[model samples]
Structure formats: structure tokens, C-alpha cells
Target: MSGITTSFFLIFAGAAVVASLALYTRQPLIIAYIVLGAVIGPYGVEWVTDLKLLADIADVGILFLLFLLGLDMQPRALIDTIQKSTVVALLSSLAFASLGIGIAFLFGFTLVECLVIGAAMMFSSTIIGIKLLPTTVLHHKHTGELMIGLLLLQDLIAIFVLLLLMAFGLGEFSIMDFSLTLLSLPLFVAAAFAAVRWIVLPLLRRFDRFHEYIFLVALGWCLGLAEAGHALGLSAEIGAFLAGISLATSPISQYIAVNLKPLRDFFLILFFFSLGARFDLGLIGEVLVPAMVLATTMLGLKPVIFRYLLHGLSERNSLAWDLGFRLGQVSEFSLLIAYMAAGSAIIGREASHLIQATTIITFVVSSYIIILNYPTPIAISDKLRRD
Candidate 1:
């Protein structure tokens, strides 16, 4: 009857369909959700007219997803990964951004538009990459570790860039703003670290025996840290990540991850599907050429540059190449950054649409590639090592 009610049913039905497809096809569930959204959304048959409601709800899913990701991360592991991943992530981002900007410039896009496009190209799809990597590969191989490492680095970089943009747009770029942001960064980290170390860890130890308590406590830890981070002018995603790192060393980390996974799946499904529903099909006709050009550059050139960068640092070729592929797609961060840019009037609605469309395209295509290659890579790695 109402928009919300109609949206609820559609989301429910769409999620089921996507879930079934994901289970049957062994494809990433996110792609299924996006496909369902595109088919059923306003641009399609108009089966769901209240995509705005769903997008708001999907924000909760994103918050929860980030929270869970935080729970899964370990501080020592993150630091180690960053130290190892810096060279690859840094060089790859620079190279990809340069290529993306050059491509956009060739298309007669403005400097700011090129900057946004460049930023978009610098990141890979965290959701798709994580979802597609095999569990065994994730834990057992140097390639998987490197992929994970670079992704973590990208997340941090994305959050900071968002922060910088916000600070600049808010006209808060004084020495005080810099000092505050800089000081806030480490303080947030230390606060999360301390909370998990002294408070959450003890609570977890006490509650580990009770699955329900463990679950609730994990949720609280995530939201609480996110709220705290928001209060301190940092991104909630960064806070959630720190929260994950804080509890990363806990004995119950694995248990927490396992128990919370279903919740993660439920929320993330809403997220990806909502993304599909928000598509502005009209802009595609106007910006499709640039979007495709940017997408192609990111999907093609990003991995190549990343592999060379890592190899230059003396990393193994297979690991470098694999990590490169894993990190090639434009990230959802690009969408978030474009939103910020739009608010600043630096990028218009058309530019934002271009970014979102290209992001979704890259996300779907890249996930498909990863899923198809995942098993083959494992088998080939074993054979080559033995040979």
C-alpha cells in the first residue's frame, strides 16, 4: 500500500532471488542483488518505487558491514600489512589515477572531473574482492595476504581523502583543522585499541561462553566505536575498522566473525541491491562514453601498474599479479567521494552518475572475473610450485 511497505516486500523478494542465484551459480551474491535491483527498480518495470527508503536502510547495512569488517581486523596484522602493502598501493594508485585523469581529459572532461575520475580509479572493490576470494586461498597464500593487505591500505587512504575533502569544503583547513584532524586520527585509533584491549577483551573473555552475549557485545563494540569516531570528526568506516583491529587478537575473534556473518550478509544484500536501484539511466546516454573509457582504463591498466610496482619492490611475480587483479576495480569509495564532490558543486549530477555507473559496471565485471579465476588460480599455483 505504502512506499515503505512496497519496498519492504520487494527487497525481501529480491534478496531471496539473489540469494538463490548466488547459491546455485557460485557467483558473488552482490552481483545477483545488483542485477535484481536493476531489473525490478524504477528504471526497469518500476516494481519498487521507494528506492530512496531502501537506500537509507542500506546505509545501516553499510554501517554494519564496516563494523563487522572492523571486528575481523587485527591491529598488528593491519600494521604489518600496511608496511608491506604501502609500496604497491601507493604506486598503483598514482599510476591508475594518472591514467584515469588522462583518459577523462581526452574525453574533454574538466580538471575537477578528471580528479574525481582519477580518485575513483585508484581503488578496487573491497566487497567484491573479499566476497570472491576463496577461504582457503585467503588464509594459505602470500597472494591472498597481499591482496588483503593492499585493500586495507586502500580503505585507510579512502577514509583520509574523504576527511580531507570534508575539511576543505567546510572551510576548516586552518592549522587548527589540520592539527585537530591529525590528532584525532591517532586518538581515535588509540581509543579503539584501548577500549578493546582493556574493556572489550575482558568483557569478551567473560561472555565467550555465551554465544548470545558474544554476538550482542560484538555489535555494540562496532556501533559504539563508530559513533565515537563520528563524534571526533573521523569517518565511521575508519572507526569501524579500528574497532575490528582492536578485537582482532581476541581468542573469540573467529567465533565473533562466524556468528556475525549472517547479519553481515543480510545488511550487505540490502546495500548492493539499493545501489542498483539508485541508477540514473538517463545520464548513461550523455556520459556513457566517458564512463566506459574510465572503466576500461581502471580494469585494464590498474593491475598491470600494480604488478609492476610490487615486482619492483622484489615481491614474487605471482603474488604481485594476483594482488593486482584482486585490486583492479574502481571501489565504492569512488561513489562516496563523488557524492562529496557533488555537494561541493565540483562535480554535477551527470558526473556523479557517470562515477556510479562506472563503479557498478566495474564492480560486477571484476567480481565475475575474480569468481571465475579463483579456483583456477589455486590449482595452477599448486602445480607451478610443485613443478
Candidate 2:
């Protein structure tokens, strides 16, 4: 118990000092958290060596993030965003996948490795996309709607990819397994709404005046649905999203969203820290050249592709470019795909290492670019700091 407490204390205290230094150096606090993680993680000082525990800690933050996204999405806006972005997301994802496939092929990866790497490239980091987004932008702008729609759609696709990969890895790709995967999502959605309408709303009404109770109930609802999603073979993030969207029509939705920010940020710091902590610097030698090429292409091309597609669809130039820059990074899903593929022996250690190294590179470099040049909640410059 004391050991756990001490480790957390170190994490937090280290975060504070690093964050202060980041501010002094005009760097994003995100860089600070990640750097602190690498320094204290098993790869460095070995203070926190439990990757499983780190992932669990990270996932909670991401769940809250998706939940908060749902909270802000009014039904009409969400529907419109989905309608507008479906084509854009599909096309953009295809382009990204092709880039990965081409790169992997050129580097002499096997067919399976090429395919898996391509699959991983089809997503942008949801946490990076939304966390850096200014609240004012998200609440008031069309850009927000499109980015949200794209990120969510990409996430759904990423989940499906994992499911397919899982079945492939187990060599049990039956019709029944496929059917269950397809059927589970809508059923879970329906169940979530029904529970919210029938059970959650009533409880909230009964305890309308009790702020503390409302808070507790909100957490319970989110975590409960998340667990249920996992049990149903979906995902906790998806479930948390459903939990938030189900309550979107409620009067207290914004109140809940507002109150959850602090706790969400608390977990998010750990999430970013864990990202750094888990990075294997030893892979740098084996994967450096490919990782650099991959990261550079993603950072340079993603924005261009997104911009052209959006512009072709008649979006404003500024908005198109902004959205492009905001979303032009590899996803957390990419790392997961590589991990799963490697564990399943679908890819070799070299391929997995390349994917991991590329992802970390893009994360750090892309973050620096965004913070230095664009408007974000944690931008280094006063002019760029939308917060």
C-alpha cells in the first residue's frame, strides 16, 4: 500500500516540477508529463514498472474524454456531423492506410505486417485531437463537429479492426463470432438509452438537489456502462460515450460535464505520462530510419489529405487546414494494434518495434508543432494558448 502511494506521490511531484519547467521553457505541459514518465518509468529510474497498471490508469482518462465529448454533442449536431463526416472519414482513413502499406512494403515488411501496419494508420489520436481543442471552439464551431465526428468514426473503425485481428489471431473467425460483433453495438446503444431514460433520469430527478449524489451517480453510470461494454465484447470507451450521450438531453448534462473536468484532467496527466513511461528506447536503433520516415510522412501528409478532402467538400480553407493540423497524428489505437498483432505472432518484433517507435516520434513531434504554431488549450505562446 505504501509503495503504491509513494510511487503516485513521485509521479505527481515529478509532474509538478516538470510542468513548471515546461512553462518556463515555453513548451506544452504535455511534453512535460511524457518526459517525466520516461524518466521515472522502468526504462529510466524504474520507479513505475507496471505497464498493465499504467494502461488501466490511462484508459480511465480516455473514457472520461469520450464521455465529455458525448456530453457536448447535441443530437442534431451529432447527426449532422456524422452525415457530413462519414465520407470524409472513410476517404481519409483509406489514404492513411495506403500510406502505411506503401511505406511498410518499401521497407520490405511481409504481407501480413504491411496489412497490420496499414490498419494501424487509419486513425488519429482521439486524446490529442480533443484534449488540445479549446472548449470555445468545440462548443461553437463547425470545425469541432467535423473533428469529433471524424475521431469517433475512426475509433469505431479501429475497434472493428481489433476485433477482426483478435479473431484472426485465434484462428476462429466463425460466422457466429462475426454476427455477435456486429449485433452487439446497436443492442448496447439501445440498452444504454433505455436505462438512462428509465432508471437514470428518475434517480436524478429524485435527488435533484443533492449535488454530491448527482456526482456519484454520474460516475457510477459511466463506469458501469463501460464495464458492461467490455463484457459485451465492445469497449469501455464506447460504453462511456453511450453513457454520456444518453444523458445529453437531460438538463443536468452540462453540470455533470463541468464537474467532471478536474477529475478527467487528473487522470489524463497520468495517461500522457504512461505513454512516455512505456516507450522502449532500445527499439530506436532497430527502427529509427523507418520510424522517422513513417512519422514524417504522417505529420506532413495527413494535414494535406484532410485539407484537400475538406476543401473539396466546400469547407472553408481556414477550417479545413485547422482540422487537418489538429488531427494529423498516429492514434493510441495504432500502438494497440501493433501490440496485439505482435502478441498474436501476426507480426515480428521488428515490425512491432517500428510501429511503437513511429508512434512515439509522431506524438512528441506533432505535439510540439501544434503547441508552437496553433491554438490549443496548452499552447506555449500566449497568442496560441486558446485556454
Candidate 3:
């Protein structure tokens, strides 16, 4: 077998064994994936050293994940969700950003580092929040709508932040440049909706009887729109999401969603693995103290802040608390932002390491808390485990 093929075999085989052990021990399976990556990664046993290939493949997982989320949401329903959750999302993000800025300053980070870290902290993990949510709740309950809405809003914020950072990286940061980039968002949205309404939807309706063809077209459309978005200076993720949203009202959307899940999971494992494999264990020690402090603070404050915001928005206390805990973690976007900022030399290595370590730490701890206390697909108790 080729080296990459051998690495894939090692990764999947290792993942399967570790996943079983995680289930047996009543731990979140995601933790197993990360641990698997670390053990066999270049820094560990050197079983897999092709980090670039894995990272590139892993990005598809994020695209599919966003696409599926868009598939689940109807345009009207999404609008309603945004209306209800907008205030909460914005306020909570500001609060989180403030917290991050304060911590970075306390640690004596540079102004640029503090600002970038602060922006990174403003998001919660869409993957963790949605993956752990039971389908019953997701499909039939208000909780899912609320969670999805807030997450969508945060994603928009994350995208804008990434664009700004990109501009900063290219040394082209300016008010006019930022304004023009922001303008491209609505323009893309308009163009995507028009294309879907006139072209994609008609084709789907015409070919509705052919399952295989329908699946192929859906995949093509998702990636095509994603590429177009990137060409227009937008993120592929935002483009793919809009692609899903455009088709959300179609009768065939649910069918597409159900079938795409297995494919999405395949990429997601690679995403988490790449995330783990990229971590340099040796560098972690240098930022250990600040990372721990930042992680602990976010974990403690997120739930409290979310609960307050949701309750003020007239959500029931119980429901607000549940939503709060579900979203109480640093996001995968945080890591992405940290990676981008560090690569651009906008943030120091220690600052970047702090974001990464804190994000992983929160992922593990938050998964444990949510699984134990809420109904999830992998909850330890049968009563709490709902698909």
C-alpha cells in the first residue's frame, strides 16, 4: 500500500478500537478520536505524518456538517430563529470576547494577540452542540431551533472575523476593504438563492425519481456553490450552508439529509483526528497555565451568561439552563481563528497554543457534562439516551 493508504488504515483501525473502549467506559467517542490521532500522529508513534493531506480532507467534514445544518432549517423557520436568538447571541458573544481580552491582557499578550484571541472566544462549538443533541429533540422541540439559531448567528460572526483577519494578514486592512467584503455576503446570498430557485430546484424536481442522480446532483451543487463562494472571497463553509438553505424548502431535502449523514461522519472523524494530530505536545507545556485558566473561566461563565440571556428573552428557566450548558464551550472556530492568526503573525505562538489547548480541554470537559446531565445519543443511562 502507498504511505497515505497505510496511514488511513492505521487511523481507521485505531479509531474503531479506541471508540469501542470509549463506549465501554461511558466516555464521549470524540475524545477517543482525538486520542487516537495523538497516539499515532507524527509526534507520537510516527504512524501518520502526512498532516497536510489529513487537514485538507478534514475540511470537507466541516463543509458537510454546515450543509446538513442548512438542510434541516427552512428559510422561514431560520428567520424566526434568528429573530428570537439575535439579541442573546450578540450579547453573549460580546461578553465572551471581553472575558478573553481581559485574560490575554492579564497574561501580558500584545494588543493584536489580545484582540484576535478575544474574537476567537466569541463562538461556541456548532459540531459539539448539534452532534450531541438527540434527533427527537432536534426535530420536535423548541430547544433545537434556539440552539441552531444562535449557532448560525455565531457562524456569521466567525466568518466576518476570518475575513478581517485575512485582510489583516494580506496587509490590506482598511475600512473600505472591510465594507466591500461585508457587502459581498448579501450579494452572494442573493445570487445563491436566485440560482437555486431558478435552476437547482427545477432540476431536482425533474429528477426526483432517480435517487442516485439526485444524490450526485446534491453533492455537486453543495461543492460547486462552496467553490463559487470562495471565488467571491467568501468562505466555502458559508457558501455550502447557503446552498443547503436554498434547498431547505424542497420536499427532497430530508431525504438528502438522511443519506448524507454517513458521509458527513466519515469526514468528521478525519477532522477531529487532524485537529489532534496538529497539536504539539511539547509546546503545550509552555502555555499550560494560561490555557487552563482561560478554559476554566469560559467553562464556568458560559453557562451562567447564556442562562441569564435566555431567561431575559422569556425562555423558561429550565430550557434556558439546558441550552446554556449545551453551548458552554469554546468552538472549533476558535481553533481555526487561532490557526489563521498565528499563521499570519498577528498572534504569538504562545497565544495560539493557549487557544488550542483551551479549546480541546473545553471540548472534553463539556462533552462529559452534557452527556451525563442531558439526553444524548451516547448518554450513559438508557433513559437519557435518545436518538
lDDT of 3 at 84: 94
lDDT of 3 by residue, 1-387 (tens): 998899889999999999999989988899999988888998788899999999989899989988988988888888998999999999999999999999989999998899998998899998899999998787658999889899989988998899898988998878887787778988888888898889988898898899998999889989998898777777888888998998888889999999999999999999889888888888988989989899999999999999999999999999999999999999999998999999998888889989999999999899999999999998888999989
Q: By TM-score, is 1 or 2 better? A: 2
- List of clashing residue pairs for candidate 2: none
242, model 3: CA deviation in Å?
1.0
Which of the two candidates, 1 or 3, achieves a greater TM-score against the reference? 3
RMSD of 1: 3.6
After superposing candidate 2 on the true structure, give the runs of residues whose Cα lies further than 4 Å from its correct spot. none
lDDT (Cα, tens digit) per residue for candidate 1, span 298-330? 888777888888889798887777777777788
Looking at model 1, residue 91 earns an lDDT score of 78
> Model 1 TM-score?
0.89
Give the range of the ten consecutive residues with the poorest summed lDDT in model 2.
1-10
lDDT of 2 by residue, 1-387 (tens): 676687788889999999999888887788789889889898898988876786788789988988888888886788788888988899999999999999999999999999998888889999888888888998778888888889888988888888888889997788797779769898888888899889999999999899999999999999998899878778788889888888999999999999999999999998888888887777678889988999899999999999999999899998899889888999988988998999999999999988888887788887888887789988877888896
**Angstrom error at residue 107, model 3:** 1.7
Question: Clashing residue pairs, candidate 1?
Answer: 70-244, 71-244
